[model samples]
Target chain A: MSAAPPVIDRLRARIGTPGPPTTAVVEAGHLKAFAEAIGDSYPRWLTEAPPTFLVALAPVTAHLPEAEEYGKGWLNGGNRFEYLEPVKVGDAITAIGKLVDVYEKTGSSGNLLFIIFETEYFNRHGRTVARLRGTAIRR
Target chain B: MNIEPGHELPDLIKHPTTRQLVQYAGAQGDFYEIHYDQEFARSVGLPGVILHGLLKAAFLGQLVTDWLGERGTLKSFEVSYRGIDVPGRPYRCRGRVTSVVGGRAELEVWGEDPEGNRTTVGTAVVELTA
Candidate 1:
């Protein structure tokens, strides 16, 4: 079998590169929209953000320029999330992210390249609201 | 809610449609074609337009929050995507309390298809008020 592609190495080299952070207010409308998008009709979201709503920060958290190139057929491996504080509507959120790691594995199916990254969301008062570590897989 | 070890939380079922995917794409800024365009999804070796993995994870998170009610806080949650699921099918999110110590409850949560195949598996911890 052939060796892993060179792109995998390029991704590995970018580890620790920080993505440009994004800032947005935790609006009730967006929260409601997200809840509705997931078919959730719970009333709690009217005033407070949903538990996983912070995943919307993907654009900021996953802003690596090289990531767009690997987007062709990549898959979301998964995510680990930790919630630190309740996000109320009208709070401002800033998401900062960086590429953590990249590696390859030769499994039963074939060769798979993985990218591991992390992001943190902070509130207006500079308190941590949530943290996320994610993985993207390319085969 | 009287959550105790071994108690199964209420199941949260979802019926995802392509329209919902579009709505999510707009709301979350994740306009990946594979999540809303059938042709693109097929080109990517998928059955059809698939739901966002984050959306599925959100459903599982909702399961915990809904069970915990207003007084609980989500401390941590994790999930690994095991399979791809297309829109237009019913997906179920369920969780069972593994332990309740002090003011925290630990749960084993997952999402599955109608066939009962696990697609997303993970665990979560919720801090409950005394």
Candidate 2:
């Protein structure tokens, strides 16, 4: 009945290593669109990024081709954001992410695979602006 | 900002539609079908298209910022999406000051479905101006 190695083990093998760093410059138009999408029209958002704007800059979860075979669907378990500086329009930011941990949990419905990952955001000055931790689940 | 331990932030209620979900999917660059494509979402075992967890986080973020105004800055904000939420229902975001010490304050935040279930629960920390 066993066919291949569990995806969790395959994913676990790459822990601590970060993927390529993605760099993007915050733009006023993007910020305005984001604010409008979320329906938050506070005038402040015209120049400054809102709290969850960082995720818009970079993906919260890394794309794992193997993990897709494990579950029929993906669910977002949660997210944590730490802001070290105010992200404003026109700031060039770079993000580097890595898989922190991977494990399997038995739930009421079925066995769920949990993938934990984190990303660090840095500004053009090389200063850390924020950190994000996320939990992506498959069942 | 009269942020006592029991201070309650004014709640923010959001009525998210499928159009907004599509908009968010584009804005966040998350083209995950579960959030936008109904057929694809169903194929993936979802009930239908669902709201992005980050969108709910944005709703909660607005809840905090709308209350704090210029009084403080958010240091850290976290949330765990405990249940699934569709786009048609109203999402109510609420939070209360859990603790206040000196220039720092902590609050518990959650987004409730129409049934009053706290589907998304989390916490946030803010540093107040002197």
Candidate 3:
């Protein structure tokens, strides 16, 4: 199956589309679990979540529902993260995701559609913590 | 550690188990079946249950953060998922200082499979205080 034209139209129609900002409280347990899962023994993770932890706030692929129309199989193209401030354990964080761009490119395997999404994390006091830009490929 | 250009950072070797993938799935709220279900992964043309690209990216982040130590701060990081890394295989995260100007240091980081392929490649900028 090829990339759906309707999906492309829907994506272009909503460029810079913003997602409902989601908020989650950073807890010590969650940090520990993540560190442990990655076998990271850094004590700092106990206090501050890992740099890439912000992506967990709202995974790029699942952040937008319109994306589901692309295809069933999904792959991560890449991610860029800018950390503004440390994410403390007791901090209340708000995550906002937006659809940045969409396009298709023909790969050696055939055709692949790329979707780019950007997510910003802010603390309860409105302090920016981190910003993430991710790309997902649908085949 | 001296924050200077041309310095090589220590390599971080990681062996992500299936159980760890499950834990990561739980912690990150990413229940993507391809990351934890071998059947689904194979059905989709993958060799097996591959580790999350974000997870592999995290490993690269750790490589820099661990090198920066306590006072150093991670300012910006980026990575491109070029290849798929299967579970149970050992992956090495390596990086080197590309340049240091003022208190800001830049690094080139990437993850390599057992075969020495650069599976994930990225650049990171860090703020360091001497």
Best lDDT among the predictions, by candidate number: 2
Q: List, residue by residue over A1-139, the lDDT tens digit for candidate 2.
A: 8787879989999888999999999999999999999999999999999999999998778879899989788899999999999999999999999999999999998999999999999999999999999999988
Interface RMSD of each: 1.2, 0.6, 1.0
The TM-scores of all predictions, comma-separated, are 0.92, 0.97, 0.95
Model 2: how far residue B86 lies from native, Å? 0.6
Q: Write the per-residue lDDT of candidate 3 for residues B1-130, one digit (tens) a residue.
A: 5778889999999998898899989888899899889999999888989999989998999898887888678999999999999888999999999999999999999999999999999999999866
What DockQ would candidate 3 receive versus the native complex?
A: 0.86
Q: Residue A14: error of model 1 in Å?
A: 2.3
For model 1, the stretches where C-alpha displacement exceeds 4 angstroms are: A1-5, A58-61, A65-72
Q: How does model 2 fare in lDDT? A: 0.94
Quality of candidate 2's docking, in CAPRI categories?
A: high
Candidate 3 recovers what fraction of true contacts? 0.92
TM-score of the A chain in model 3: 0.89
TM-score of candidate 3 versus the correct structure, residues matched by position:
0.95
Error of 2 at A113 (Å): 0.6
Error of 1 at A81 (Å): 1.2
* lDDT by residue (tens digit), candidate 2, B17-74: 9999999988898998899888998897778999999999999999999998999999
Cα lDDT of candidate 3 equals 0.86
Query: What are the per-residue Cα lDDT tens digits for candidate 1 across B18-118?
Result: 89889988888888798988898899778988888999988898888878887778899999999988888999999999999999989999999999999
Fnat of every candidate, listed in order:
0.89, 0.90, 0.92
Which candidate achieves the best DockQ against the true structure?
Answer: 2
